[model samples]
Target chain A: MTTDTIVTAAMLAIGDELLSGRTKDKNIGHLADLLTISGIDLKEVRIVADDEEAIVAALNGLRGQYDYVFTSGGIGPTHDDITADAVSRAFGVECIHDPDAMTLLGDMYARRNMDFTEARRRMARMPNGSTHIPNAVSTAPGFVIGNVHVMAGVPQVFQAMLEAVLPTLKTGATVLSRSVQSPFGEGDIGGPLGDVQKAHPQTSIGSYPKFDGTSFSTELVIRARDETILAAAEADVRAMLEGIAASRRT
Target chain B: MTTDTIVTAAMLAIGDELLSGRTKDKNIGHLADLLTISGIDLKEVRIVADDEEAIVAALNGLRGQYDYVFTSGGIGPTHDDITADAVSRAFGVECIHDPDAMTLLGDMYARRNMDFTEARRRMARMPNGSTHIPNAVSTAPGFVIGNVHVMAGVPQVFQAMLEAVLPTLKTGATVLSRSVQSPFGEGDIGGPLGDVQKAHPQTSIGSYPKFDGTSFSTELVIRARDETILAAAEADVRAMLEGIAASRRT
Candidate 1:
């Protein structure tokens, strides 16, 4: 892995269930953490419905902009599962039944005495010239076409697929962060925080406020690819918080 | 409210915390449900970092494609909270401190014997020609410019702002859905499911699979604006599930 390479990734979460508010998404955060630790920056995320045009457009929009594009959901053996076809359309490639995928799924179903119907056979199809992404939880495999990786939407299956794919890619410098909180409200700390941000332009500072019905508080987090810069920003934030506290006391 | 009108919306979730995986968003689901009930369709959702260019690009991309664009996060009294400025840039407008927002926040702080510091005054800023979306939980108000609505990132404050804004907007016919689950896997029901989908092109049919380590199952959901079409598609799905179950029993 090149140390200078700033690897970036985007996620396409495909499902109507997500848009309908029936299922809360758990994959975005999981994949975000995975990518962050692997030294790949998660740049953007788009959640689209299971529709073909929506999937194709989002796939096309993201795949070219980022180094890697990971998609979760819509690979199941159902009519609504149009991810594979949409991916094929996005890349202008033909989707075919890969022999390896067929063998893995066919044999597994045979062992279970389950009929591998035509709908089940859809699992074996992938964009032409793509490789299979193994699924340990279930025998059905995900596939990678170009830089876009298609994976399951199920939380457990998505995690397993991410693990399977992570090691194969080259990683860069890991982004690190430090968090600090104060009873001081965001308004109380905003001015000094801006000064802190200007002093450390390399680090990104975020202030999140929390209200417990009676009082407001803020948690400030500083992040950077360099540990030294991250630490320096953290120190400045701490000093600012202390200054705010002192003013409140006096 | 027009029954035939198709109301569409896009969401821009602006925060480094979201892209960094430090925060699990709870506002998307809440807004999705709110939009569904209000007869507006949430067509797309984008989670972007706190960076100015990224937010501006996403804001422009989504705001044009959908009828309404709702933004969450970054509207706070903090240095990293750049959402108001970003929105102003997206709309080619000036961001200035609004007297209405200042009065509300100023009085609230005065009641608590807290000084309305410069940092706190930042919360009163909004894009020019915008209207305020009152926040009941916190004194800081969200604002709307053009078709774009900017709200807080905190769950409580975001929800309160949404409630205040929703009632003022025009709504369309509600998109309704019905769901059913079966122990039969998706592959077991896929063929007939396709036929069902073909029979009801106006309604969207989705098939979601579940695995419990021992067996596979599927949940099917059908949705449409017209209740009659939605009900008819649901019947087709239920019959398909029953046929698969009967075959399994025999």
Candidate 2:
């Protein structure tokens, strides 16, 4: 859905594996970065158990509230796979064995010289009327129903599907950023840094402090819609850091 | 916060560093697991820019919707940090230097025999009338206000603070789970799998398919409050996989 203003999107990552710490979610961050660059506001994110109600609830909450809803996980041939069914329930569609998806599965398996078992065929199940979103790195494809974009949870597959899907997404004005780093500790730099931020009200400047055991470093990042304002803030931050470092040395 | 039925929580991860990919967010998954195990349902999570409005908007949303709100990050002695101010605004409370937090921070720095900068002293700020949540990790303690529990974003500190704060919460029945793995792809099992699920209404069965270069390996997880029901569902899953694999071998 194309929007003149910011397009908000929600993310639903489903799996017990993630909560069990067996898997760290890489897809959300990738989407956050990708959507940020594309100018889509990622408004809300939820991670739920593989329970059908949980999936459906998350889907219902996300679907129409934002321009797009992205769901990852539970679209596989194994027993825990329930996302397609949940989506079917959420959208009130039949969990049909789509012929198009089946053909793709059949072609891929035949090319690989493998027997297409019923378990293998499960990958073709989609909510009726949903369009397939191709996976560049894997054979099993992702799909879209209404605003909910359902994809695999596997990092490689998720990323490939994201690349495939992003090109077609109706985007917004991109959020751009720049940064300046300092060797000084944030404690010695916070107030002056706050002043720098207060002075540049249009451009948002954020301070991040890091410790490397023996020494400290802080990064001041300036972000805005306007490139010129962002650049000006970056220079101001650099000047502050240099002045502080020089004063500290003396 | 104690409720007879349930305690819901939301996680707020603040850091421009995380958004920039300079630092990986390690606390989100940890907090999710800990809350799940404690029988506290983690309903929502947010990662925000270090801007005050962003933090305030997220804080207000979680505080209003959930039984308890847990925030991590931006409570440190740094200029980029503004969660305390944001939270104060959300709560409509004056954020004067909190006496107890000040005492703890001062003592911690005094023990190290180091000079505490104005930024270091900034860690003393807390919303008016909040209760101090003990920090056994580094001693720059967190605080609790109403249903909101503000903790450090560092994994170790955040975890330690969560453990300390969890006892103050009212818990619900613990969630239990079990898993079964199969060699066949998901398609071979969908039809019968749906039937088996229809038979066992109490047990929630989740199917996850893994794309293993040449073949698909799927894992069926059966979850329920009743172990007997879960085991029965597991037995049915085993039989389903056997039927699929046998057919594949032919």
Candidate 3:
């Protein structure tokens, strides 16, 4: 990929708990932040149930569209943890018990004096021809098949797996952003801000409205890959806010 | 919809800020919880950037697949706030400043001694034949056209809009759930849990692993619509855990 080539990614959070509201997702934001800083744009995110068909459909849809697809949840040893099988089906590959994963998990269980039960052995399963993503917190490793990086549903394990996988993927130019806080509300600055955004076509300008009980304020953010372009857009945004502030004085 | 019929829904979270990780989303979980209690199954969730084409595509896709579609964000006055237009395009309708919304916003602005400028007036833009979803926090109303309910991006306002719109929709049977904490880890219980799940095909059983820095434990949740069925499944799960504990003691 070229230097300016945007490395885009999508996230697939697979779990019935998420859709059922039993578990609030922390992975989406965490992954988005990590991917952004790594110079990979997180373009889309889908949260689906633990159903195999849903997981397969979402994985296929995302893996084809983005450079990388990171998935969390549905990788445990339980019956509902079917992400590995779903991913295998998505790629038309056989879901198998890999020897490396089996050995790693067996060793961990032995060290802890555990029985390495069939349920625990279930963690050794992965799609054929996939690489293991070592989990530092728990020894049951996640796997990488095609462009999809499957990780654990547990936050600690998911984060650790991401850390292990991130360094290996190709990245793009890190996007730089500048925030300009407007004392006035979004309604107050929307017109001029739109003009400023149009003037700076290369940059993406977003206007966020904030409510602090008593009144409303706006936070304007300008994002771009080029520092010079970001700075130029920042100046225009600052000037626009100043113009609004001056008019309010009159 | 019939009484026993399941009412399903999908959430579309729109904004560039969300995708950029500049804004961590709180709306998806909030909506999921609300929908769950209302007996509406939140089947899927998709978060996309503030692009018109992307917004239109997501809206159309979600609106077709689910009984109800809720969208939050990008209804502000700025240029990037293109959700209304996107919704209009999704429905193939004209996006216009509704007369009622214009008057409502105009009256509120006048009462607050603020000008209903062109920027603020942008809040009135919605699909031509849509009904307003009132915002108690901010006077700028969201709108509902066809099965799609579009709300503000700000958490406070989005919640307010959801409250207004939720009461007006049809709901299904409330799903009842029971949680049983296991003294053992997920690896210890995964096998028995799988057996329990197989025996009780009506109930959806989920095993969630929890790590508290020192050790891992599991929380097993059983969900179903019938109270008697739920209780039966709960009993089985409890018995399974007790059996595991007895075996460990021996």
Candidate 4:
């Protein structure tokens, strides 16, 4: 894709553990940051349980809306690992044991002198007409069907799979951002920051309040795809903070 | 709700920073764990941007499906902070400055000797017919309208608001969980775990793979509302692990 093209993406994190709060998700933020730097706009994220219907529905919902969909979790050998089947259902394709995946897994298990049991063999299954995403951390590869990239739930495997998948996707304009830390709280600069944001329509400005044990402060962030526009917005935000500081001093 | 009744909930996290990867979300997992213990099933979580249309659409989509909906972020004083307006639009109600919230904020600013500007006043606005969810950490109150509870983005404030809202919620049967640590990897236990899951249909058994730097292990979790079912499932899982260990030793 051209640099100016706007590529969008959504993440679907599938696991009953995530929904049950047994596991706090680390993949969503990791994927979001990677997509942002790769110049893809991450528009939305959904975390659903391992139930096949829920996974299928969420996959269909996100796959249609964004340019790319990345899913983590539910690709293991366990019964609850149903993401591949759900993705196949979403795409109206057959879930099958891919020969390439089977061979890779078989070789790895043979080298380790471990029996490739039926449960371990389950990892070779993927949606038909899908290509495997090689995992450096694990032998069982993730698969990509249509625009959905399915990866493992383990953080290391997920990150390794992403490394393999990211290079293949099309990218858009890289967003640039500038942050201004203000000793003043949001209450002090919110009005002026709002005005600055309106004036610099090219920039998306955000005000985040931070509370230390004793007091509060604000961090103003200005983001844009264009460096010139981003710099302009940053200047305005800094001026706004200075104005507040000066008034307080006087 | 009665003890046996299944009370489900969904969380909507509204912010641009979350999607941009500028900020990692802590509230989703926090809320998920809290709800799980309080007997509320957290079925789904969606993270959307700061845009008004996106917020309203997501809010509407979730509020009808779940018994309770919790939203964090986008209620700050900046221009991009538009969750309050979006929630009002979702409910087709006018967002007005609640007198109680206004007085509360006004008194807070007065006590701190800070100017109560229009931006600070914006925090007092909520949908009509909404009751405030008090924030002990900060004076700006969160609010509850219909089944939706909107709270702050800051972890401290969000937690304080949750403390105030949790007691008012209707709860279901407290789900009890048992986790068995397996020395073997998921590959070894998946088949037997699936069997245990099928036999003990009353419990939901999940296999999660854990990787240290060198090797992989597994954690099997069994959850059920009934203690007897949970115990039975745990026993089966332990037996399965023991069988694997015995076979390997021989």
Candidate 5:
């Protein structure tokens, strides 16, 4: 894949539970890893409350900016499960109970001898002109409206839905990263490190510092689509750290 | 505090680690809980990468909209720790090494026989005309420039710095929430729940559903600054669920 062939995606985490500090979102990281591995650069993430206006605004902002916008939560069989409706409003489409979703859910409930209640029927609703994203774990399948892929809030079900959706999407070149840990502290090597970063215009370099009880250490990470440039930048970073550490010893 | 005197805050979590999915953010939830207790509405959250332009844009956007803007991560002694510089640029100020910060770090390092090197001295830097937000976990303090409160990335240090900063800020009436769990599924009671929500427009009602192996249950939460309204809304929600459950039984 060419260096310029980069794909990007954004995520909108829809839940009052997340914003209320009741639920620590595990889906963002999980989705980020999946997107990165599949060569799609995960650009931005926004977490909004379960309010329709908030979800609609966030969805519009993200779907316009990124190739794919994934939404998690608020698609359950409840009053607060308004993600599908909000997404529909964002895309200027009517939310309808898709017949396919109804059949799938109806069959699942019948097999289990469970009541196909009205609330359960709500799960069959999706925005008009959209298609279902299969749910391997749960019968309540998620749907895709425009560029947005609406998925379950439950981690297991979300992961399963993502696995199903990924195969059909277009993927770009893999963005790889290399990390070099330096025994020397960040302050000890910041100048030379910045110089190395300035020299490698194509690669993005990051310095993460940790202060143990006695001393400071740093992990220098370099990311790029091209392995050759990335390796070259990583070498420069390593040399810069070594020179700093050597000068400090003397 | 009057009901009209509600305050709002926004958070910006900076770092490539968070964007790359290498680091799971613990600060957003921590700050959300603190802000909620202090009656500050956390209006929005944005997670941006370690790019200076991204940080500056987010800072400008958030600080302009909210009463308070809090930043987490990227304020360390490293090349990648460019939050202070970005914030300075965002506010059109110079980043300077404050005298108090120099003294604090100098004394701390001196006691431990560690070199107060140039890179280490970088920790003393803050935006011009800014006051240091003391860090109890580490001597390297965070700072506040304009309405933005820049805090450390480490969870322990971030919490300590926030504790130090919160006491100095103006706080509002404590917003409270009451939750009632109903054995009835969301689908069973969504219509009535929506009606109750419309009737109690003052209180924000949320319906969260959980599907156990056998059936679905819902947690209906009502939040408001006024206890009377919140309690009244909670009662309406409870009655709505009870009526639905009773109807289903018959």
Candidate 6:
């Protein structure tokens, strides 16, 4: 298998508040950034609810398709937190409080002489035969069962934990990116952009035309591994957009 | 069922750039806002890549579990723009360019004298037997195959499309929301919050602690349908938060 072929990952962002507009789920973006730097292809990203069936289905689908699966949220202290149970159900593994997770959590609270109640200790539960992904920022540790890495929903904590675990992951080829932005709609750029793409079949050029109330702007993106090819592709995109912009001006 | 029975919905955010952190998706928040007003419980939100398999799997998972599904992204002129096709595949329909969609689309371009190329024409190709979701901002449209509503990934366009279509949606009794922010970490509020939650079993309270650089604050949200019960829960949350904030002052 080639570097491009080896590793592909999926993100599962799980939360109810995220869907309610109460909170923006930032964990997926963070994981995406971290995973990409480590050369893991973030092939899929999913934001699912706290529901058992939905989470189970997503976990199964992603695990079956990709090399690694990273799930964030529904692993908190609330009643809505159901990731552990659902993951256990998905893998058919026993969902029990792992000793290592409990010890870490206990030490965290014991250092301050705080009560680690049943609810707080709920964070210690892990799918059987899985390793705990340490929580550096918080005591609640995420765990790995099969290919799925269960993580925190909180942004800072999620990033820190992912950084810790990413080093151990098998990586794919690092995806390279370059872009060109212009004050025009995508339609104006499509025809020429398509021609450029037809030439550089290896590179993926994306035209993102944004329309605000005032005016429209198009951000053309060229993504690939080869620097020379990416640069060549980007030059063509710039030329196409410039030609369109020049024509529109006239 | 009862007004107490929850009405659930899922958000499907489809984009590869979002997974790269190259773009932070804001449509989930917009969808959440719109769904909240309609008494539709935004149960889950998912972000997928530009790949067709990812989109199709997400659609199946969300559509199977939730009462309704709203998908955003992959509905543009680019080659990776495949949300409509994936939805078609998910519903097992022949992904065809419908005649009605073509008529509306033709009329849209006829007014402007713009040549509708294959890429532009692709926008009009929705699932067979799907309903057209009119785009107020752009002539390029979204469609509804079953209960799932396909919308644009752009925030403004997504919100506009949702507003246009939501009125016709089958919504339930309005969900009431009340929140109180405390200058404390979630851990600090966890104990008392647990007690309050136990006492008010009818209401579901969500705690989100935000760290703004130097200090931390938690927003405690209480949501339910019954007006009197919602008010009572709000008062309790306010009292608890005020107690914490007042104690901090001393």
Kindly report the TM-score of the first chain in candidate 2.
0.89
Q: Which residue pairs show backbone clashes in model 1?
A: none
Say which candidate scores most in DockQ.
Answer: 3
TM-scores, chain B, all models? 0.96, 0.89, 0.97, 0.97, 0.96, 0.90
Ten-residue segment with the worst summed lDDT in candidate 2 chain B?
B1-10
lDDT head-to-head 4 vs 5, winner: 4
Interface RMSD against the true structure, candidate 4: 0.8
Against the true structure, what is each candidate's TM-score?
Answer: 0.97, 0.82, 0.98, 0.98, 0.90, 0.86
Q: What is the C-alpha lDDT of each candidate?
A: 0.88, 0.78, 0.91, 0.91, 0.85, 0.79
Model 4, global lDDT: 0.91
User: Model 6, range B158-205, lDDT digits (tens) per residue?
Assistant: 877887888888788877888877676666667677778877878878
TM-score (second chain) of model 3: 0.97
- Compose the digit string of candidate 6's lDDT tens values, residues A1-250: 3555558888888876877777877787777777777778787776766779989987887799889999888776655677999999999988998888888888888997877877677778778898888876776888887788988887877887887888888877777888787666666566677789899987877767688775557787888877888999988888877787688689
Every model's DockQ: 0.82, 0.37, 0.86, 0.84, 0.55, 0.46
Q: Give candidate 3's total backbone clashes.
A: 0
Determine the backbone clash count of candidate 1.
0
Which has the higher lDDT value, candidate number 5 or candidate number 6?
A: 5
lDDT of 4 by residue, B109-159 (tens): 999888999989999999999999998998799999999999999999999
TM-score of 5: 0.90
> B52-117, model 3: which lDDT tens digit per residue?
988888887789899999999999888889999999999999999999999999999999899898
User: TM-score (chain B) for model 4?
Assistant: 0.97
Give the fraction of native contacts in model 2. 0.41
Pairs of residues at least 3 apart in sequence or in different chains that clash in candidate 4: none
* Candidate 1 segments whose C-alpha is farther than 4 A from its true place: A1-3, B1-3
Residue-level lDDT tens digits of model 2 in B4-49? 5566777788876665454577888888778777777776666776
